[model samples]
Every structure is written in structure tokens, then in C-alpha cells.
Target: MKKIITKELVPGMVLADAVLTPKSNILFEKGTILTQKDIAKLTFYSIDEVLVHDNEIGEIMTISSLPDGQITASERIKQTKEFQIFKADFEKCAEKFKNEISDLVAGNKEFDYKRLLAPIYELLQKGQTNSAVFEMLNNLRNYDDATYTHCINVALASNILAQWLRWSKEEIETATLSGLFHDIGKLAIPEDIITKPGKLTSSEYSIVKTHPQKGFDVLKNVTISIHVKNAALMHHERCDGTGYPGGLKAPQIDRYAKLVSITDVYDAMTSARYYRAPLCPFIAISMFEEDLQKYDTEMMLCFLENIVNTYMLNTVLLNTGEVGEIVFINRNYLSRPTIKIKNDYIDLSKCPGVYIQEIL
Candidate 1:
């Protein structure tokens, strides 16, 4: 199963998913083969893409890249046209903080706490602005350096969650600070261990688990609130008491720590790593659902409903050699949704024999 853009739509190709409108109504169904007339009608909907299962070719069709000559000056300008200026400013702050992370871990006597908190202050000017900035940075252009980029991404996501939870202005600032510095302890660990392309040995894993305590020790003397300190110390702890450093369970771990933990796992799962390719957001969400016991149920639900909803729309795909668009979502069971292809409706919740084999 695969996804192909509208330009690739052709007669005889089956839909793996369903095509849906914003109103949650099906436009087509799974297993419905495309026709020339159907393709012509799709343009009216402003749909630029569709997922199709091409059994004859043995793959799903997808638009791989932007078209040639499409990278105009206007396009580049649009890229920099931020929906929220504060978010852009916050990213600059994150970048500056990243520069001193190594020095903090090396026990530098000159590390400055006020300077470290500057980004957090900038991120809290307005909750809505901060949230917009967080979203913008999450979709920011990638850099070759994965560690720095991953850290920033995690910080942005964590900050958004904190804002959504309606933490006090002061608490939101501390949460952002904690998230930005949560992985600072990694600097004390060997670079080889941090960037190893293979699985870690048991001894290496033990060293890796020491990051939380290491981060806490580095910030112990720093002039910051206790909320910030605790978040850094317990971001790796789980609700199920199955996480590392200290296996503190629910209630034992602070709410801020739990919030950071969820964001940490989400960023790690979605970012490309030395050992594996980045997982798709949908797949990562599913994985989190399966491990719901490991996180705060209310927070996890908020993250999914509020944050993820923005990205889950109009996604086309193939399911078991058929192509379709997602017409509706089953919040309780995200894996099974109503899909529309050409002219059919697939009620996955009722179709025991059908399954989504791939994401186009």
C-alpha cells in the first residue's frame, strides 16, 4: 500500500484508505478504484494528494518532493513568514542556551543562571504566542546535528504542554527551563555512547541512565526554582514506576516531571536517531497509546487531542493494497477509522478482515 499525490491519480488504482472532508463525512471508500472522471472531480476539493494501492507496481504512490522551479523567492519568503514572532525569538534563545550546555556539564565555575533563564522568559510573554512559537519550532528546518535539534524540539513540545495545563506563569517558565536543560547531563557521558550507531551494552546502558542525577547535580547550585530542579531530575521517571534513575511512580513524580517525560519520549520517537529511522507521528502516537500506563492519562489525552490534531488531517494512505483518505477518526481506536477512496466507505471498526498495512 502507498500514497500518491493527485497528479498521480489514475484509473484502476484501488484506494487503501478513505477520502474525507473536514466535516468528518466520507467522500469515497476503501477498495474503490479510481476513474478518470473521479480524478477530475477531486480537483474541486483542493486535494493535492491521494493514497493509492498499486498492486500491479507492488507499491504505494506518493509525491516524493516539491516540483522543479517551485522553490521560488516567494516560497522561501513564505517559509520565514512566521505565524508567531515570539516563537522565532524563543528558538534563538534555545540556540544560545545550547552553546553553554557542555560547559555546565564540565563543572564550569562561570556558568550563568540568569542567562540560562532568558529563553524561558521570552517563551512566556503570552500563552497563545508561546504555543504558536512552540509549534513553529517543532516544524523548523532540521540541522545536521541531531542532538541539539532534538533537545530544542523536546523543549518546545514540553513548553506547549505546560502552557496547555494552565500552569502558573512562573511555573510555565520553570517548566520550559527544565525541558531545555533536561538532557544536559548527557554532556558528562561519553560522546561515543551518546551517538553510538549500535545497541548499548548493559554497562553503557547503566551510564546512560545516570543522566538525570548528573543533570540534577549540575543544576543543584544554580539559582532557579525547585520546580525547575525537580523537572530536570524526574523527566525520565514513569507513571508505572518502570523508568530509570529513580523508579518513582505516579504522585511520587511531580506533574511537571510527568509532562516532560511524555514530551521526551515523543520527541525521541519522532526524531531520527543513530540506531533507527524516525517513526511517523501516527505510529509514535499509537505506541504511546499502547503504553498509556507509563504516562499520565489526562496529560497524554490532552497532548493527543490538542497537539496532534493539527497534523493528523487530510492524511492519505493505503491499507492492504487499497488506497484511500482518512474520512473520520475513532478517538478511542485511532488505528481503525472510516476511510473513503473513489466511491466506497470503509468502516474499519466494523470490518474485522481489514487492516491498515502502511501509511502513504
Candidate 2:
């Protein structure tokens, strides 16, 4: 079986795995052939791509990285190293505008074009890594100020989510920058409010709510595109009209803003915060699944499906202390799946005697 990106999906590919949504699960039954219409339907579900099994996995050409289900943590670590190097090179681009606040203020001038181009070149030069960059960012949280790191982490998560939705390369880049600076206005807020380490007062919360507008004001003079500014301003807006700044609903919100909103919530819930300990990925995914109506259903499905498939190759130890590689996922119960030991298969879904304790 080979994984293909949605852009590369074509007719006549047989699904090697099942496709799922927040409300339903559709297993294509291993050998089922996919027609163009079937492919189109899957695309409507925000499926970036599907794994098709043939004599062997065939390559599907795509400008963006294809989602491969068979990626390992070690491989993710390698990708993280590559990103670190890219970040180091990219930071240099910010040097030219060091003394120019206007250049920095202008969203366009702040980004290092060379650095922006490096990662894509590297991704092409090397092969696409199976996992998204967010997984790596999640592991890098030992820095002093957690808020800034959290913002960066949220941005990475948002960009990965947007990429999974098969947005154009230009849109993906703009979304990424927007995610990175969505909270720039927070820079102007009082530090005490930003890091209160306790419940915020209604007055303080009001101040916090002004971040979107403040961020837009800060970048108003910058050369950054309107999409980026909107992302910063509208990320906090929710579909239920419960979000801050502007209570925009469904069609009123920008696509990028919606994407950032989901990513922001996921990162915040899964990270250690002043109010609570971090939630595990499985739990976080479940929570997101429960609230799918609050987001673009298709995008939410894509995010959940990608995350489940991405971690399948990692080594995990069951509650029974049995260690093995995740070789198969049960469509009905994603949290539990079949594991492959030395020479046998342990279907956690069917094996009532055993269970997964934790992922190592």
C-alpha cells in the first residue's frame, strides 16, 4: 500500500484502508477499486489522500508532501532536526529588517523569502516525512516562556492542518505565517495578564480579547497579505457565535481563521497549562471529534484521520506490558488497534484479555 496526497488522487486506485469522518466510518474493504466519483466524494470529506494497495505501492506525484502511514518516531526526530536547521537559516532573513519597525510591522517584510523556500526544497530534495511538523513542535517545549512557544506550536499545527486540507502552496505559506503571529497583539498586553498563573478576571479576559484587533493594528502598515491579517484577527471567532472580537458564524469567518481556530484549541488542550496538566493525544483527538460541528467537518475529519494513521508506526507498550508495533487500525475503534509482535498479530480491538497501557 502506498499513501497518496489528495491532489495526486486519481481514478482506479484501490483503497488499502478505511476512510472515516466525525459522524461515520467507511471502510473500502481492502481490495475495492476507487472510481473518479468515489475519489471526489472522499475529497469532499477533506481526505487529503488515500492508501491504495496494488502489486506494490506506486508513486503519486505531488508538489506537497504525501501522507505516509508508515512513519516512526525516529524518522520524525530526523525531520525535526531538518526543521531546526531550516529555522536557523530562516531566522537570518529577519536580520535585514532588524532596525526597520515598519518592515517588521509589514507582514510581507518580516518573512525571509529564502528561508521560506528552503523547507520545500529540502522536502523535495529528501522525501516527504510521514508525520507533520507539529508532532516535532509538541516535543520541543522546554523553553522558558510557554505562551510564545505555544503560539509557535499552534501555528505549526495550523499549517499542517491546512496542508492536509490540500490548500495551494501560497495559501499554506500565508496560513503558516498567520498562525505564527496570530497572537502578536498579545505583545502589547500586560505581562501579568499574559502569565497570571491563575484564573483571569472578567476585566482581564476582556483585555485578552483585544489581541486580535491589536495584532491587526500592529501589522496594518506591514506589507503582509490580507489573509494573514484576517487569520490573526478571526482565529478566535467560533462557528456557534461564541468567539470573541467578532462573533462571526459559518460563512462569515475566513477559511484560514477557521483552520487556525481548530489548531489553536488542539495545541492548547494537549499542552501543559497553568490550569491543568496536558491531555494525551488520544483524549485530545476525541474531544475534537466530539465538537466537529464547531469546525469545518471535512477539515476536522482529515486532521483526526491523519493523526491516527501517522502514529501507527510508533512503538507502543500495552497495559499488559506487551510491546509491539502498531500494524493495523480498526475502523470502528480507532483508539485501539491490532499490534504486530515478533511473529504474531494482537488485535487489541478483539483481544479482551489485553489493552494498551501507553505509547512509549
TM-score of each: 0.68, 0.62
lDDT of candidate 1 over 33-84, digit per residue (tens): 7643345435434466777776733233343333365452223433664534
lDDT of 2 by residue, 297-349 (tens): 77777877787787787676664556688898776566667899889998876
lDDT of each: 0.66, 0.64
Q: For residue 223, what is the lDDT in candidate 2?
A: 69
How well does candidate 2 match the true structure in TM-score terms?
A: 0.62
Q: Which portions of model 2 show Cα errors greater than 4 Å?
A: 1-132, 143-145, 275-277, 317-325, 330-357
